[model samples]
Target: MSRIRPQVRISRRLSTTAGVAVTTATLLTAALSPAAHADTRPSRATAIENAAAALLAHAASLGLTSAENTSVRDVIVDKDGTQHVRYDRTYHQLPVLGGDFVVHLAPDGAYRSADRSTRAPISLASIVPKIASPEAAGLAVNALRAANLGTVLKQVKAKPELIVDALHGTPRLAWRTNAVGLDSLGNPVARTVLTDARTGAQIDAWDSIETAAGDGKSLYSGTVPLQTTPSGSSYQLKDPTRGNTYTGDAQGQTDACILSICISRAPAVLFTDADNHWGSGTTADRASAAVDAQYGTDETWDYYKNVQGRNGIGGDGKGSYNRVHYGSNYNNAFWDDSCFCMTYGDGDGTTFGPLVALDVAGHEMTHGVTSKTAALTYSGESGGLNEATSDVLGTLVEWYANNPSDPGDYLIGEKIVKPGFGHTALRYMDKPSKDGSSADYWSSSVGNLDVHYSSGVANHFAYLLAEGSGPKTINGVSYDSPTYNGSTITGIGRDKLGKIWYRALTVYMTSSTNYKGARTATLNAAKDLYGAGSTEYDTVAAAWSAVNVN
Candidate 1:
């Protein structure tokens, strides 16, 4: 859960709590559970929340503590018919900070507990997709970011109305991406739009896809191969002097986050070319994109290869490159295919390094990795995961560095930025609610929360699973996690969790992977690496439930 910053699910018990603490493990123990076929059914967010609340209520009742004895919080399930549960805490004596109980459920519905907590091992990779799946792959595309919509709209230029339609509908991926032109620097420019599944109405807009090839170029040009060689968990950046030292795939100029991609087309940073993303604010300074770019790549690389055993963006032992100093005062960094690199900016001085933080570099790079491997489409449920992946991996990279110059740790983006805007890294995994907004898990009304902050649940869960529940100090940083049922989790090394997650992501997860899918995948992953009925498996399941993934 250590992203550019940290995300954790902590079940902290107050110095006092005499009531409402009855809970038990709800892990389904089936010999060979029913067949799980992936379902292509469109994911309904409303369903996730409803089911979660009902489950919460169910968990609340499981507590052994009597009502007058203590406060209770539990994952309630909506009996109307949704198999979901969530994390909730209640206070019996709010004024005194006493009598508070909480409950958490795992998305897999396999394991759970309340109050009295003990860390048990559980399998990882062997965890399978949720039973909701109707097929082997399940529902895939969930593109719901402003950037992603922009990318889609850019691709379907001929149908502008689809963009509006999507805003009013369930939103589907029924658009085609088309290249348009090239920026002054020669980066490809394109446009896209979404259409109604039935009437083909202008339901949405997808951002464009930028590339080194001309706008007319195909995703895989006949000349340039689509990485003929399989990528993996080890790579060296094309040598610094390889003269591969160019940027702007179109013009081959050296730049980072140059806004050189099809954002004008598919504006989402993930889909756009790195060059096109170079916003002018950060690039305007003499901005040495050099150190920042190299720093990002190296930092990310060490984390994956050394800590997580992941290759490059492709997870096939490939190495991604870095581009620096883009545009006129560019203020941010991003990852893209054309450059396959990370960019940076010179902050307006509110913060020192415009590059944000070393952890951010890993964050953006991991996004590329996530895009290629899990391909968790950027939207709704998966989108939150996608963002969380970036944060988690970014933090892992910092920890991997263990550099005196940087001293990588859980404090994401701290070295590079001190934002006057708000928290340095946009969100906090340790306590999603710390910012005072964002929900930690599925709320029947989760759509109301910002994807960036709303992801706190998953983020916190990951952190707690990695470091254990409760307050502790690491590298001088004091941390505490709020858990369901007011219990505690055990700490597993960040490096180990990173590997399990990486494997689950690149090897097991599919485009349609969701909260439920993530649970199963991680559980399965634990099995693949640690063995069935191992301590790892139990903890993995317990951690998920701790966040109401149940």
Candidate 2:
């Protein structure tokens, strides 16, 4: 099985300035100051807004001109009061692609350092498009159609927005168009096309759907407990505890779309049961699959909330829904941002069973998490990172669950892949190359591989980071992870790995980050969480080197 998603571009530059060290006397003096007593600390939002305003006021130092403006994308205030502010830039009112950057400030609001997506100056010749929006949109639709060659597309629609393409070489006026329609399977297919506004040539294009190769009987996890909502005499497969997240029976229906319009969408008919007991742990019962889907969703939600401190997938305490039995023998699962939901395929039965495994559920939901945070473009190295992020965290989610039936392992989708698939699992984090297509070490050509296979680099790094090199048995599963440079590495434990990677994804990484960027992000994250030169920080560096990232 394979997966596809959208893409972005990134190049980073670091600018640092020394901050004055705060002394105990300075702190005591400030604590006793009348202004300190009179001024209550501002709200987090206010402080971040104030910081953005201050940073904008000194735009020249940040490599920005008066013609550029910024809006906040994300903000992180550390335990030590250090602030990291991420912003997106607009040049002359046109969005600047790859013009995003993060500014780090000291506790005293002094400039410390910055990570810019691109160091190139943004100065487009003109915002006006000679090719026009309609023409650009037509080209985008054609590109989309060309990409999906044998499939008949319906409800085809293309929407083009003009932007400054700072992502590619030399910032220039371009049209970023999203062309969407339904594939032959009735699955919504979309491509985001970037076209040179002046020349009317296609610059770049990528699939917008975030997908995973594989889902349930109560399938993989055996029989699991579920939280349901009472609706009259029957119970709805909705968990009130986890933000009303419910599992709906798609009833073998698929989505219908034309261009941007979704004419006949699959209805998430609430799965209702008279007795509260859901699923017989077999596909013979419809509630059986629903049970697995609901359980997987619950475990994923709990893993993020309990281990990662995220309130929900978006960290906003909002729940995302799940749709099971999506399409007849659909064979794939996806996390759709537009619907804020997870949809699973029933599989062709020979290649796969139900697409609702716990790790698969976690993997799909983590896509939502990535979209909310780094928004790593789903192509090239960044796309690989995006997929690897999900794999890493999804593995952690399985470990966090500690379910007896599906004990955690470094393998992904082990429960979903059928015997006819000719593989034990969809992916192996400890030795990704075992699957035949994945790359175990980083190389220039690694980015040229599919995002799933390229993700092997990070997955290998994560396995080495958590379990180290050489053979070992974790939870009865054996692994012998090797390093790229043949250097021995000692395990740092998965708990620390989770903390470091989560922080990197949420605080340090940008949308366009690549393999090298990921190394930097994780190193910075380790330094933030475990201190510079700490064992954990050193291990993070060693792990990346083991994966040939350095």
Candidate 3:
């Protein structure tokens, strides 16, 4: 999202902490450093230090006690000197898992408010663990094995880290372990398991690899221009203009990783051609699929940079590489934060093609964006919102590209799913229930559904916010959106909708934000974009209500 400053007023009493002073001079120095020169801005290091200092100065006001410490995770500064500082906390030197939060500051460095992952206070009867680390590792490994039942795992390994488990319930000592191994297909699979330190019981376990299912044709956008780097004599499939983001052939291999360490990573063999002209429009040529992958990356990069003012997926001006032709007839694509890259699969011809469609690329890349920003927990309502965020922005990326061959539409993965798949599209944002599994509106039982299907509520809301309810046709695609309440909403346009949602995701939403929290975040975002009671703000409320979010 763009670093747009909002004139928001948050009223809260600041807790007093003696011997700590955040002077105006310090704030001015940090804020003005970015504009020290007309052509230059503050370095990343400088910004981070400044943000850390700012947060530490007001630790007490943020509900941080003397036993707690804060470390800066991210810093976002607006042109008007407004600041959003993200932080990860620790208690008595132990890492706090759900202790992350964001502190908002006005232009003058005045405290606005703080959004925390949890409101529960951090305390422990004892820091000592009844369960040993090695035992925890074994439990984690067993959990991983159970997840991959009926498969023989190779090179299995597990590493455990002691942490305070604030995310799952009351804060308590816990062991967070990452288990990695090669699956039956020789594909690398990893899962993170959380086990109670005192009790041997498993608290939670999730696959570390984030994934979305779909496929697409080779050169799905037809012939498109590419930006490649000249390596020695031939041009390599690397775009230096976009942080040297290169597309590589995985040679049907997957990377085995544990946390940030990869034991055996598939070679990202760079694609080099004698001439820069990369691909023909057929799957017979490997470069054809590579072309679609690279083009999708380019368009996604441009969409965020040009449309949202985000420098990159991480908002750090660094490009992420893409790996295509990833396994034999693999029917899925995924984003690996551990590898910081995108991996696409070659789908079975009958059901899917190459899985490198523009929208698919956009969708997968957006997962990285969400990780860098809100880092929404990938379960329940937050997980649904996470998926919806990708779908919403991915669709916007398609429209931003405006490629005639693959025109913008709300039908996701349409180019990917063939007739054999028995579905017109992976999802229908206009009416998510059309997919036969997705929810049409929010209900108490919505959270019980899989994240992909639960995402329908927000997806439906986004469609109504952009296109409104009732029948409509745009770019030759017909849509009939219904509302929970029989109220018609007049769209304020996709551009405004994007801005509002982006602001909510980056500025207002927290890691644990649910459907209700999402509604609040979007409303706050709308109020920030337009004035409160403005048509845009009212429309945002109306749209959420239409999805039964109210």
Candidate 4:
């Protein structure tokens, strides 16, 4: 793309750490053990009912009751049968901001504790806003302008919602305004501005759009099947069979942003060709990149649905479109949650060519999955995990595709690496430290490093968990993974690794989960998928320990 979307784009940074040595004997001794019994439990419905009843019994003390019009938002069950039920409340039929809480339940369905986002109850004098809705919208736009986001073109929809502000200060009524448009790069833009209805003071503002910028191929992925729609005269790039996922051409303009708010993007005109067959497998042809972008989108959609049981990126079975040939020789790709689309860049042709490589495609799209679920904050250890999640799934997608042209391996961005980049890939899971910056083992300061580098800890852990620590070859790729405690970990196979990680991501992880939280999350995931004392569970524990995540 002409301008890279800055918010969620993955940045590759290189830094080094002195390897903290540990003895093999110590590692084996430090390995994690099963924490609970694996006996069969009650049916899901029964367990949920018991947990709900337990929470209701303590509702009064927790500032919740039937009169508050609170309803369960989600119910999460951990491996130890602990239930975490998140509830959303409404005050006088109006949604209450900060009126959400998670009720923790013991394995026996007893109330253990409750974590409330808001400290105080949803007690408000009036739910009505003193400021008019139009005036609230104006305040939001002004706030956006104050934040250097002056253009507010696309005005998707603006509405006022009531929320309580007890967490930050004294409880009071507020209005939350959601505005979406386009940015300067034609990528989607959005902001949720919270204003004090009593005084019209801007309380908070956050970008609604989660972005990470993308693709082509014929240049990357080899000849592949594409789903197309016939538009009377010619076929369009839209895929009707796959939730109508389509590919549009930016035509290198980068100024098609509309709605005044949308970023200045190349016009997203649907890609159409006279012949059904597209692309020449070279950057000289525009369809080449479009072909790669479209193919990648299809593969990613299928991978999530068929492998992970996810219907779509948002798990809603809705097809998202792709923008190809974005900007002139842009060197990055990103995913925009606001637009629900993936954008790809044509590589500068030096260090990179077209970025629509198979794994990269999967890597970018998994960001959306991360956004929809867990919603990991893009900083610190959580950010590292976020990037690692994408890398892990992206590698799996490549493996799932089983493309001969680009075989699946622990190497990322392998196909796009420049000759003089020194390393063959962007990051190496087998030996992440080989990237010159990634951490092979976790440390207290790991979170302080660049997320891309911090992800090395998890990447190395995944490699050991899946293929073990040793020198080996798979699909012509060789990997030798090292551990923190200098221990040898046996392989659990990639399929099991994928299952455990996916489960943890969708079920146990939260926005603020850290490295320690990740260990618990995966352990719980493994226990839930396998038995508590099962080999998978032990392997997960062992893997985390090997990476110094314990």
Candidate No. with top lDDT: 2
Clashes of each: 147, 9, 2, 39
lDDT of each: 0.45, 0.79, 0.78, 0.70
Off by over 4 Å in 4: 1-217, 255-265
- TM-score for each predicted model, relative to the true structure: 0.55, 0.89, 0.89, 0.71
Local distance difference test, candidate 1: 0.45
What is the per-residue lDDT of model 2 for residues 107-132, given as tens digits with 9 covering 90 to 100? 66767777877778877667889999
Q: For candidate 4, report its TM-score.
A: 0.71
For model 1, state the Cα shift of residue 216 in Å.
Answer: 40
Question: What's every prediction's RMSD, in angstroms?
Answer: 18.6, 7.1, 6.4, 11.8
Q: Which stretches of candidate 3 lie over 4 Å from their true place?
A: 1-58, 149-152, 214-218
lDDT, model 3: 0.78
Looking at model 3, residue 448 earns an lDDT score of 74
Write the residue-wise lDDT of candidate 3 on 337-455 in tens digits: 76778888788888877788898888889888888777777667887898888889988999999999999999888988888888888899989999888998999999777678888
What clash pairs does model 3 have? 215-416, 216-355
lDDT of 3 at 472: 88
Model 1, 190-216: lDDT tens digits are 334343334433343333331100111
